[model samples]
Target chain A: MAALALPILALGALTACGAEEETGTPASDTTRTLKVGYISGTSLGPAFVADALGCYRDEGLTIEFEPIKNPADAIAFLATDKLDAYVGSPSAGMFNQVAKGAELKMVASLGSVNTPEGEAAPSGLFGAKSIKSVEELKGKRVALLGSVGSATSYLLGKSLEAGGLSFGDVELVTLGSSDMVPALKNGGVEAALLFAPETQKAIDQDVAHALVDSKKAYGSSTTAGIIFGTKLLKTERATGVSFLKANACAAKRFEGDWRKDAEIVKMLADFMKVPENTISGGGLYAFDSSLAINEGTLTEMQEMFVKVEGILTYTDLLPADKLVDDTLRAEAVGAA
Target chain B: MSPVTRDQEAVESTGTWRTIAPGPAELDPRGYARRRTLMERGLAILVPVALISLWQLLAGAGVLESNYFPPPSDIAASWADLLASGVYQESVLASLSRIVSGYLLGTSCAVALGMVIGSVRLLRVALEPTISALYTVPKLAILPLLLLIFGLGETSKILLVALTCFFVVLINTIDAVSSVSPRYHDVGRSCGASRWSTLVHITLPAALPQTLTGMRIASGLAVIVIVGAEFVAADAGLGFLVWNSWNLGVPEHMYVGIVSISLIGVIVGLVLRGVEWLLTPWNR
Candidate 1:
């Protein structure tokens, strides 16, 4: 008993030490470093552009980019104050955390379907050769690029509605973006909701074709964005505002035929570690220069998740004001 | 009377060995041992309970972040909710089905192959090195290839568990069969026993104990590998529940899944120990 109790007591002491570490030092007024968690994807083009163009440097901030596996992980890190901000999609995790009183808020939009003409959809549902349309996906396996509660599931849910089917109509399988195209090719899934480069890959491989265009399926929907944790939300609001200002500066470069810009493409390629052609060839996400968040999309996401069941803990939708804070983006927009 | 006084009186009075019936006060010879066993069991239960209570106290007092390490009460509530929803039962059943199928298939095949290789010098010389090489390859590393071959279904997860159990049981079985005394086989042969008779009567009983121990170890490995495979491959198992709950930002549900997995591991260990006891009575 003493043996077991000793280790447990040691663990308690370690936890107490961690609590002390969590009470981090205050940031200086002149310049502050923000620990940012992000996933490498085309949707985060603005951040890559910001880094390459020295937008963050201009704002008197040092940005540390930590690559994370999932937006959920980012949410957890942000809530725990391990990350100052996260560049990822707003998912059930974010909403649930906010509902549970985690001091975090989605401050800016990263990617949306609202774009000018002739640009490819940022993400869409692709079907195998045998599956030509969403209607053909009935009773078939449809793979999602992330977990069931991820932002991609919103796109998938909306796309399925076009065929008069719900998320329940087809079997939903969760797979990583890298595995999406292969799963489609191998009949592991009849269709899949693919993001950016993977969507381009499915078309290039000739194994799958577009079943639903995300842009057409849900117009002006913003699911991916920048979210601020407690540090940015409460303690260091100016730093958060400056972070958004930097993002707004980068978003200016994302306008009309941005992928055609070799420098921008090369910068993104270097940051994301993919080839230049891979960044240049694929559809780039539409980003708002002012970082205008779509609260309606967020509310709708919660409702859809609630309808799906087992994703959201609460039955009722969390109000939009509780989930988002537009003041940071508004300040940045005014500054820009 | 006190046991020490009774013993002294008997020794001084008799001066010779004599059997005496136990007195009423000393009716149960194992009373002290029984009390010791109960005390050990009580301590076993008490330690975990004490640790959990400490965790609850810390979490409730806001020292440990409730978001990350929720109080045990919250976890218990989530466990009850999951049970009421039947999600917990379904996840357990899914994982158990895969584990059982994989364990039986892997162990039976391993024992059969091990017996053949161990009994024959030429086969052992040809196969042991290759088997050893394959054994050293991590089972989880082959998951992607298994998914590719088995197509992201239950088959891949089951195969992963089977592969994990296979190597452990195979090595132990080969060693156990090989190390059976040559004198026992010699005695069987001199008594005009056939090859089958020598194997069944002499070699089988000698190797049974060690093989059962290997089987017990393999059972635990099977559970671990199946849970890991479920994390990547399957959509309805305990690993998926844990991952999904975490993704959904429900720490309570994740804890429920984790606790369920631990319980399953403990139950599997106990069940295997019972099987070992029943199968190898001589070891008992």
Candidate 2:
């Protein structure tokens, strides 16, 4: 008798769920929890600021930050609707996914290397003191955070290009950013493309010196940005806009050397579990308050990756429209 | 009926009745053995084929996402592509080179040291505990130090494989040598055998089976350790192939690397079994 009742109950529950789907009712904003993937550190400055300042709560959303070791994992999760949003660099992985018809997009630029004309960009190629120029890198090992398909690899190629060399000329070593400075010091690699505080560490330790500023090589460029998955892109776009609004609200705080702000520094330091000095000492990554996507830079990145054989599945470039949706960012910025 | 009656008469003569089943050898032994071997081979092939068919079905029906969980056919295509491109061949050769070099180096050193330590009481008492403690430490944990010491090259990865295989083979070799039968040693001594002669004829032969067993286990460990080390530290190898493909958002390529590694493991296991058979005749 109980077993018979159980099937009937289950049928009734499933019917109720089906009816809810049939009605096509929208979910409440307050009830929404956005799962955002992130790689920890200053790249996610705005998200951290947004979380700390309760911007997400104010916008009636709970932001669940999931730490990811690689952007590719986030891309996979995003395509499957496991992650609603992610903050990471634009990589060959993202482009390859788009080529494969995954419905994920770079909705907003998180940060860019917008260094002043005279100053060296904090993110660039740093090499051993004895070998001063990119030409010296010929036949020498140069490390990057990822392989030939990595975004940093593009930067390395550009730096190499300036010296009239190509990736084929040098041995490419894959090392984490933390390992870069040490590798340079210990001669594991002759040079490495390092980002801040690592770049700072290299200079301070007298191990390696900046050889090429990324700004001079590529001009003002978006290094990392926010991505939206199918769930946010098609199903619950309002929540996506709300997420961007919270992020944009926090981006206002990132204006003009945000590292100087004591509260921001403290919040970020606590969130990243690092000393306050580390936050203040590192070079600033610029975040646009409007949450704009640099279509030009995205084009450049795609072109660069497409040129490299076997890095991307498809050779043809994906138009900017397919890779990004500007409506969510526009809505978020308009609301602000 | 006639066989039952005859068996009953035999049982009555013996004053007891017992039912005994005939062994496979008694019931057409050659055919039985052939059937068993055929069944084993059939199941081995059938299970994986069934799994892959199920996977392809699910992927086709959209139960599994094609991008992340690519169909087996797609994986095969990607594997072929990699092969044609020379990436798969390069990766396999790299990993094989590391595994072979490290496995040979580690086992040779371990066996020599283990024999010496096992023979001398002072060395055994002084060193066994320390070696045991070191063995308990995770071999991969020292990879960072190896990288620091040896730099990020083939040396660190090769050494990591060696280190992992070393401990496993060392402990087993020590145990095998130390546990050789006392009667065998006495036989050699009573025959007026020299120390070297006893070691060669009596102790080594006694320990060879266990030592080979250790080597067999170390071969698998060598493959595992090298793959793991390659994931972090290498630009080429099966492990790197999997990692780089994933990084490149080519899941099919990643699957190819994974399948290749698994195939290598199976092949290595069979080769080791052959080695054990050749080395230990008495065990057979």
Candidate 3:
């Protein structure tokens, strides 16, 4: 009886292992659907436009958009193998996921904002209106749209230090950009660092003012929006690159003639549930058609991320070249 | 005469052979007590020890991916961190206070309304169908509507708990009160007792056990619903803790929160059982 049972158990184990291995491998079929999860924040506009334009379908890829409540949830879903890609705020939280052996790689760059002359985008100590000047914001509450360890939060901390304000002097509050407007209006916070449309809303509402644009603060030609993933990039590189190319096209179209792209603007307005005039007047940031991830900007971002958030401890920071893969992006842009 | 005597003798011998055999010494009072004590002590230690050992072994072997399933050690560390930081305590206390307030209010209202409806056939006929229909619908399906109305504050969370608990207690109270025998009421009437007196002395005691059982069920349901209520738009609470950990992609912390919830459930179950035992000693 024991001898008979041993063989049976072994057979069962073998079958289970074989089954898992077979299913675990990525499907070889090029026509496989890619399910992308994204937060319904303004960051998702380009991706939505790309989807709307049938870019993914044109490349023989089926795209499905799953709305996540927050960036953290989006990242979690991506890490758990529930999503092929997640588009949300660039955060050190993503770094935490990467540290856990998830094979995620930043793929393509997206939208970036330019600062209006004489005013910086609202962010840290320098951005606080209560300070009257950068010197007065020496010890005040500053809010970031994400967590303490997030990318924006770290960048804000660096920006404050550069402007002669130490991070220790300012208290950091983690709040969403949508919540930040009301929070600032209520004086629950002194200033909040946020990205566009929300930043524009803040300025329009007169609840808060822009401190400094990220590009101005960093004083570098940084890529604000970038696509990141691994499995999808590897298996569906052409489709992924085409998706970015479509977004670039949309961006160019939006920048070239805002009036002509009224439909796109209207769609964005409907999704945001704000007035069309408000959206149009928001001075929305646009991305360039270049699919390349600027090496210089990434280096600065990595350094800032490490110094402030300790996202990658000194030993964990990989070489800059390995952080980005632009071959597919190049191919797609070349075809265009 | 000789054949009759032989048959009688065989019958007598068979009757003697069929006498009861002696039982084991442990069946006696002293031995039995000792055996029971030993069994109780063994049970007291064995289950927890076995569970902990298994958990530790599985965790150490990386059987369930530490980030996702976290080992006992990691959970313990997190628990310690929470306790030391005072965040866990504060959230637990806040949630407990809300749950208790909602539960008490719900139970009191349910009992009063149930008694009134159960006593009056007209009211019962009018209300039972509506209440039953409402009960058939899932309690969670109305959460969005509640949030819209209440704006994701304490009132909404408490209301959800109350809503779920109220129906359970109401249904149970109705069943308990209505199940009273007609004979008891008849006897009370024959004794020239007042309606109130009859209800207080005879009907109430008979229904108390079932009513208490209902309260017990409602209490457990309150805990479950309260957790769900806290999940959405909550800044603090065990449910919020689970949600936060899930969002942060710390699956182990999520599991820890879940396990803590189960512990709370078990504790609540034990309390309910104790209450049942106290109210219905006859069940013992």
lDDT by residue for model 3 (A86-188), tens = 6655455555566666556666665444434554333332243454544455666676655544556656765675567755667665555666666676665
Q: In model 2, where do residues sit more than 4 Å from their true spots?
A: A1-29, A116-120, B1-27
Sorted on TM-score, best first, the list reads 2, 1, 3
As a whole number from 0 to 100, the lDDT of residue A35 in candidate 3 is: 76
- Interface Cα RMSD, each model: 1.2, 1.0, 5.1
| Per-residue error (Å), model 3, residue B257 | 1.3
Model 1, span A216-335: residue lDDT tens = 787778877898898888777767887999999998888777888898898898998989998888877777798899899998888788987689988878888888999989988996
Candidate number achieving the greatest lDDT relative to the actual structure:
1
The candidate that achieves the highest TM-score relative to the unseen native structure? 2
After superposition, candidate 3 runs with Cα above 4 Å error: A1-33, A51-54, A57-64, A67-70, A91-93, A109-227, A232-243, A256-259, A262-285, A291-336, B1-65, B133-153
TM-score, per-candidate, Cα-based: 0.89, 0.92, 0.67
Q: Write the per-residue lDDT of candidate 1 for residues B1-284, one digit (tens) a residue.
A: 42333465667888854455665436765886787789999999999999999999999999998987899999999999999999999999999999999999899989998888889989999999999999999899999888889887788888888888888888888999999999998899899999999888888889988888898899988888877777777788898898888888899999988888888889988998898888778888
Tell me the lDDT of model 3 at A239. 54
- Highest-DockQ candidate: 2
Stretches of candidate 1 off by over 4 Å are A1-29, B1-31
